[model samples]
Target: MSIVFEPVRGRPNSGGRLTVGTLYYGDARYPIRIEDRALAHLKIVILTKLRRNESFALSWEKKPADGSGRGTVWIHPALSFHFEFSGSKEPEINMAWLEKMSESANRTLGLRIDDEPREGEADPAAARAGV
Candidate 1:
């Protein structure tokens, strides 16, 4: 199975920016709110999980404190997937994977494999030299 992210609405606000999105798993739809903190945490978790090749389930309920709506997301850790963040608006958060997600949710969520860094890229000395 795969997951898809589609941005329905995006706007900046006083407290913070809000990303109103839709997550798709088959016929089911899950509304997603990507707060700045939540997005940061999500990126870390995704990258770490990909690095270790460890699979785990991610289940969360979407119950807004403001009472817009409620939904749920069931993510199969082992499944090949990608998360695409797509919309006309720019977000305060910027990350490589997040950028790809915006373009095409399916492409981001279906990532079963990720390439390891090049020989020099992983080396601290080389990285320091800007190689």
Candidate 2:
């Protein structure tokens, strides 16, 4: 049997900034809407743990529009993940966000999408380089 997940509301096709992408898991039957920029960074951290053969639970709080609940999934190396981006260009990454997320993924509760750290904590090298 397959489970289907629909977005809380239809996304507009205004091009560029209006598009919302999907992260498909569980044999592509389960779909989660995520912005390209955030999803890109998430993919990096998730893949790292999976590459090490680690299995963990990933939980996310649902938005108010999405019924205001929570969802959790057990991610294992055996499962597949397909990230479908709506835009052609890749978004810039924040190293500090990656570091914070990596730390969370290592914890007992597993990965939770955390907010990006404030300035000065973003990237030490990039900051020094005046980027």
lDDT of each residue in 1-131, candidate 1, tens digit only: 22222222322345455543333343344344343333443555555665676544344333344443333343455544443343444344434334333222234333221222232334444456887
In the order shown, the candidates' Cα RMSDs to the true structure are 11.6, 5.9
- Relative to the true structure, candidate 2 has a C-alpha RMSD (angstroms) of 5.9
lDDT of each model, Cα atoms only? 0.39, 0.69
Largest lDDT belongs to which candidate? 2
**How well is each residue in 1-131 modelled by candidate 2, as lDDT tens digits?**
21223323222234634455677877755588776666677889989999999988877877766677778788899988888887677766778777767878888898877655555554745666899
TM-score of each: 0.35, 0.75
The pairs that clash in candidate 2 are none
Give me the candidate number with maximum TM-score: 2
Off by over 4 Å in 1: 1-16, 22-37, 64-77, 86-131
Steric overlap count per candidate: 14, 0
